[model samples]
Target: MSFLTLLDYASVLVFAASGAMVASRAQLDIVGFAFIACLTAVGGGTVRDLLLDRHPVFWVADPMPIVLAALMAVLVFFTAHLVESRLRWVVWLDSFALAIAVPAGTGAAIELGHGPVIVVLMGMATGAFGGLMRDVVCNEVPLVLKQGEPYVSCAMIGAMSAITLVWMELPLNIALLVCAAVTWASRASALLWGWSLPVYKSRPPRQ
Candidate 1:
């Protein structure tokens, strides 16, 4: 199997785990767990593929992601209670997924001969939109939409860094590793230190 293919599967697994955690917290049934897990696993990649005009969609082309996601959901359903902090665990898992997915998306775009701008956008979308869909369905604020969160920014930086390194003739595998490391480290730091971007301050209207 290709490295990118492996990355894709890993991304699906982590994202699915995050979704399952959310479903567990919501006290959902097995079916609910499966639904959310599938959604989170493929939601962002689906969007990226559609936007790039890739036919048959990814999960349609390869059913392993679906199966893996469902399996993860079932596993979490039985084991969730062991996790004392479900919400926190979900966030970190999603971050790991983001780290993998961003480079996966960017590499796919680069292989497709897409330009830098499209590559960066696709990378960010792939990393973030899954979590966005997950939170929306779970009735919680999406991390990308949360005030001051550096979620999307982290993806962007990692994607751009990967692209730049590739442009510099670095090996694709090396670039991907650096990208994932940068993305994960940035996100982990944010979570550990409560770091966030500056929010807009609206001024009061003058009388």
Candidate 2:
């Protein structure tokens, strides 16, 4: 398989893992696990494909990603008891997924003949929207909107980095790796150190 195809499958697995972890925390059953897993695995890519007008969608064109996500959910269901910290595991797993998916999305857009702006937007959408959908479905605050987290920002930076490197004629493999590294490092640092952008504070209405 090509590198992009490999990244797609890897992102599906990691995102599915994170989704299943969340389902476990919510005391969801097997079907719930499967639903969340599939959603988180394909939500962002689905959106990106639709926006880009890709026919049949991606997971629809190839059901392997869905099957893989369901299988991952089953594995997580069976092994959740062995994990002492599902929440932490979900965050870390999501960070890695973001790293992979960002480049996957950006690369897709680039291949579609889009310029850098769309490439960056598609990359961020692919990296962050799936998790956003996952959290919304799970009834948790989406990480992208959460305070003291740099989720979307990390995705944007990674996407831009990849696009910039490619624009500079760097090897695609090298660009992908460097972008993934930037995303992973930024997200991991945020999770480990509570790093975040400043919040906008609005004044209260006059009493």
Candidate 3:
């Protein structure tokens, strides 16, 4: 069990839980919960793998991630109503998933000898795409598309931070850990304190 594989599994589990919460909010059936959960778990990595031409998508190759996702879906389906705010749970879980999955994507790109740009792009894709898909399917606003939030930026910066650490000749494992920490911290700040980039304000035409 390589560390990267473990990252994938962790992200899949967390993202699946988040997806199931969204399904619960939508009042979807158990099957719908599983469907949304599995989609949110693997959609991003599936995109990353396909774009990178990595033979055999991660979930397709091992299927443990899918199984894990389905199990998480079942758990969340039964317990979601216990939460007073499923939306908050979904956000926090998705943030954790973003942190884990971004590092996994960066590591994959780095291992493949891809340049920094590809690393950053893959990281963002892997961290955000699943949630985007889940939200779109569930008719919720996509977090990545939310105004001013640093969602995609968090992934990008996290990947670049990993690259910087690697360039300093640090251990790859340490770099990945830093990546996860940076990504999660960025997201947490946004969620907790409303940290965000400046958005252009629309104004009436001046005379």
Against the correct fold, how does model 1 do in TM-score? 0.96
As for candidate 3, its clashing pairs are: none
Clashing residue pairs, backbone N/CA/C < 3 A, model 1:
none
lDDT of the structure predicted as candidate 1: 0.92
Query: What is the C-alpha local distance difference test score of each model?
Result: 0.92, 0.92, 0.94
**Candidate 2 residue 156 C-alpha distance from true site, Å:** 0.6
Among residues 3 or more apart in sequence or in different chains, the pairs in candidate 2 whose N, CA or C atoms overlap within 3 Å are none
Q: lDDT tens string, model 2, 1-207?
A: 778878889999999999999999999999999999999999999999999998889888889999999999999999999999888898889999999999899888988999999999999999998999999989988878987578899999999999999999998888988888998988889999999898876776843
Runs in model 2 lying further than 4 Å from the true structure: 204-207
Better of 2 and 3 by TM-score: 3
Candidate 3 at residue 143, lDDT? 87
Q: What TM-score would every model get versus the actual structure? A: 0.96, 0.96, 0.97
Candidate 2's TM-score reads 0.96
| Model 3 residue 154 CA deviation in Å | 0.8
Candidate 3 per-residue lDDT over residues 1-207, each given as its tens digit = 999999999999999999999999999999999999999999999999999999889887889999999999999988887899888898899999999999999999999999889988999999989999999999999988889989999999899999999999999899999999999999999999999999878775852
Q: Which candidate achieves the best TM-score against the true structure?
A: 3
Q: Candidate 2: lDDT over CA atoms?
A: 0.92
